[model samples]
Target: MKARASPSIIRRSFILPVLLMLAFILPFMFLRVAYLVLESSTLCSSPLDCMRLRLFGGSDSSLIMKMERKVQSSRWRESIYWHLASHGVPKNLHCLHLKLAEEYAVNASARSSLPSPEYMSRLTDSSFDHVVLLTDNVLAASVVISSTVKNSGNPGKLVFHVVTDKKTYSPMHSWFAMNIVASAVVEVKGLHQYDWSHEVNIGVKEMLEIHRLIWSHKYKYMKGEDFEFLVDHERDLEFLSPRFISLLNHLRIYIPELFPDLNKIVFLDDDVVVQRDLSSLWHLDLNGKIVGAVVDSFCGDGCCPGRKYKDYFNFSDPVISADFRPDRCGWLYGMNVFDLEAWRKTNITRTYHRWLKFNLDSGLELWNPGTLPPALIAFDGLVHDIDPSWHVAGLGYRYPQVSLQTLKAAAVIHFSGPAKPWLEIGIPELRSLWTRHVNFSNKFFTKCRIEE
Candidate 1:
């Protein structure tokens, strides 16, 4: 221990420790260098700022702030993209329509798909369980018919009245004609087939212009605080989407006039799939209430947070505030059981027309776009709260929040939100439930590249 070590031995001993230290420090140094290189593009706005950031590592919250901005921008872009997609028909479905139209034009059997006179008579007989569906989609109509008939206890009693626009008439009729539902009677009628007054047409046209203006320039009407609600407002606007402003969407108000012989009917949106026997809905006593529907209050989840009257109507308007309570809860419309007999006694249609004119005259300030707002006003006291299990809605936007138990127990599941099941943007899990009812193996579907 007293002996002095040689210079070479001492140097070797020091070198080993130094090498270990360098090895440990190198990784951290490399990581820092990589971070700087990766973030070079956004290191700082100016040369001085970059130098200061590198030297002091101060005011570096800018990086995190920039990241946050990017995230927000991404979300906004996503919302806009979804809105655009929802408003248009999917390419595959458009292809299906074209192929079906071609088939209808040439194939004799395609034109003869309507049920015989004996079964066709049952449409107006009203003894059968009548379900009304208004849509221009051929695939959707097929799914609705297929699912309802498949789930019905008495399939023979189920009759579907499918209404479509003029453009979709040929394809819609051909589809039902070629692929007939054995148990159910499907009657496809076009808008042109219906006989209504020119006065009614003018009223709808005026409403259209008002709605178009409101939707086309939605942000123009927003107040300072309202911008905070832009996220929810965008979602609400889907209900009144431009895609749904067609004449068919307005036809719900005139249900009594449309089907005079039917005492009652189950109105189904094309976006819904029936999971249980709907015959029971026909038997439910509405107790003088014009419509039997599931209340949004019972949702108990995000799928359908209870909406109030104020959520739909403009309470700032004197007429709206005087007549409607801001806190009054709203019911859903997708799977409603309407007592047409009761509706006929009331001036509901006239009231609807009056409000439509009033809203147009007031410069579209009364409510948001879409048919639901006017409907909520028109059917104010006439909604009968049916069992929540009968109709489970919000499949389009909030499918994840809905539990398996609830969905399994539901008689009808509605994709009330913008993401309709047939669309590419539709959630995969929920889409499967709707697609299960679709006949993917059908020749027409295969020919048109329509797949699961």
Candidate 2:
């Protein structure tokens, strides 16, 4: 200061420290940006997770985790509500229900005598072809029966056993009674008609309660947690939604007990349309396996590339982790051949009930809330893989990237996802496959305004 330092000396003194500071900070900043870029590409597939890293600072790990959990919780809640609202009984179905109900009130003969003594006796006959369909949706059930009858090699031999809830019993009965398929015997029965044991009734009640708790996010209360979990493990809970869970889904687990007189039966979900003759399934030897189904994918046995046991089970628990492998393959439920004889011989039904009880005891942590997961565990190693061509699934969600030749060749096309062919959200391109089976000219369709 006394010497009055030169201007160049003062400038160099100030610039050197500033340059050093930028050099030190630049590397760390570059490293952080690279880390975020890599994470965004690989780990942050969820849009919400990606947004958080950009908008919210990442210095506080606890705060970041909390924000992520909150966002995921909100998303899950929104999804559950949307699914519930979208899947409610559609307007056309309600209109048909009302029209049928009114018809029943006016015409006593509208309820035709279904399953006369001859067909009633055939219900337990092992010689005839038996197809069991359980559903409450009248239009869907009609499509299944109509398509199946239309595609059968011997329609006279086909006998359909349709089971429905009491509320839809009259409408379902009326539909089958009024519109008789070509030579195919249709027997419609309400769930109340069957005599369920105390344990069976209790199991259904418990499973339904668990399904409700899961979709509503109240499962945390059942799990002893005061708040929703940080993870969205219930993403697949839609498969167990009200549309899927109803008495029909639960009834599949007890097929052996439900139809004790039958030897083998082809179980069809209402969402499927028969494109070709399914009579061959009756003759195919199950190789002594209880459940004969097409593996969900074409992947080799025990080597499905997409979903596996780990997807359906909570492997973190010691019991599940010890008992099952995560890589085991999963199969579909929409179209399956159940060998009731072999099923009864083994403890499959008992095993199913045991697992259901165990899942309930574990606060529903053993598996998700659909019959498929427990059925996977109960029927482990007991599934006989059928030809993939017999059943082609996943037609309901979006336009599947399948060839027209493949669709034409598939014996049964299943609209198994949420976007049912009857729903407005159904994929337009695929909806035709199902709607073509509907007789739009029928008086019922005209009355209910059911058109493609």
TM-score of each: 0.88, 0.76
Instruction: Give the alpha carbon lDDT tens digit for every residue of 163-270 in model 2.
Output: 888888888888877787879888888888889889878877776665555434434443464346524444453554565456677778877767889999999999
TM-score of 2: 0.76
Q: Compose the digit string of candidate 1's lDDT tens values, residues 1-452.
A: 69999999999999999999999999998887666655544434444544556657666787546555655655656776786678887888999999988988999988884766778789888788999998988998888889988988889888888989889999999999888788788898888887877887776667666557656544455322233333555565465456656667767887786787899999998888989988888989998899998875445644343367777788999999999888776788788999999899998877776787788788778887677788887887888888888888888883346788889999888887778898888988889999999888999889878898
With a 3 Å backbone cut-off (N, CA, C), the pairs that clash in candidate 2 are none
Clashing residue pairs in all predictions, respectively, total 2, 0
Segments of candidate 2 deviating more than 4 angstroms: 1-85, 197-234, 237-240, 299-306, 399-401
Predicted model with the maximum lDDT: 1
Q: In model 1, which residue pairs have backbone atoms overlapping below 3 Å?
A: 113-177, 240-370
